[model samples]
Target: MELKILKQDFSIGKLYDVSQADLQNEFCFFAKTDQENSLVCPTEFMPDDMIEREDGWRAFRIQGILDFSLIGILAEISSLLANHKIGIFVISTYNTDYILIKAENFERAVRVLADHGYEIIH
Candidate 1:
């Protein structure tokens, strides 16, 4: 599988609550469950309602739309990064999965993935 590196830096945060009006762009992920309301969005779009937040993140996505029947794609990539001690946060949409790594580890993570034969596109 191929991976495309995203250009923007990101922020992962926990918000008290959210409404449609809170969302500013398509380049964001928001999940609300019994436990909490979470958001993964570009740094510039980070909202002020955050109860907790972490910045300095960068991201990439598995290239192309992934069929539901396909298995182990995320597991394989996560495992590879785990072995390198690079931590990650993931968000999945209907079409693909986005993996977030800390800014400090982004270059090393890219190099590791490239060395393992996963084509990395800028």
Candidate 2:
């Protein structure tokens, strides 16, 4: 259960699912319509359009060693956010997990995670 947290700033951008045929990398889009809506690796990378909007988004890093051996990591995180009425989009890589919260609930979600004993890097 050892976790290393990193405080990094990331722009909260809008994600839109476009037709696979219409996608272009220059557009900064994330995934195609056929891909799952959940977090995806940058490697299986698809066209993700990063749009600048008036709304804000929250991005955080959960670094350190993770145990894939531990079941329910996603379930635990989802449940934690659910209790606070926050929604999340989770992406994972070989090393760690990245959780994206809507811009509106970003602060509250961070606080809740901190209160629950997860270290807040920032």
Instruction: Tell me the whole-model lDDT of each prediction, alpha carbons only.
Output: 0.90, 0.55
Model 1 misplaced regions, further than 4 Å: none
Q: Give the 10-residue window scoring lowest on summed lDDT in candidate 2.
A: 37-46
Per-model tally of clashing residue pairs: 0, 10
Weakest 10 consecutive residues of candidate 1 by summed lDDT: 17-26
lDDT of 1: 0.90
In model 2, the number of clashes is: 10
Measured on C-alpha atoms, candidate 2 has an lDDT of 0.55
Q: Over 4 Å off in model 2, which ranges?
A: 1-55
Best by lDDT: 1
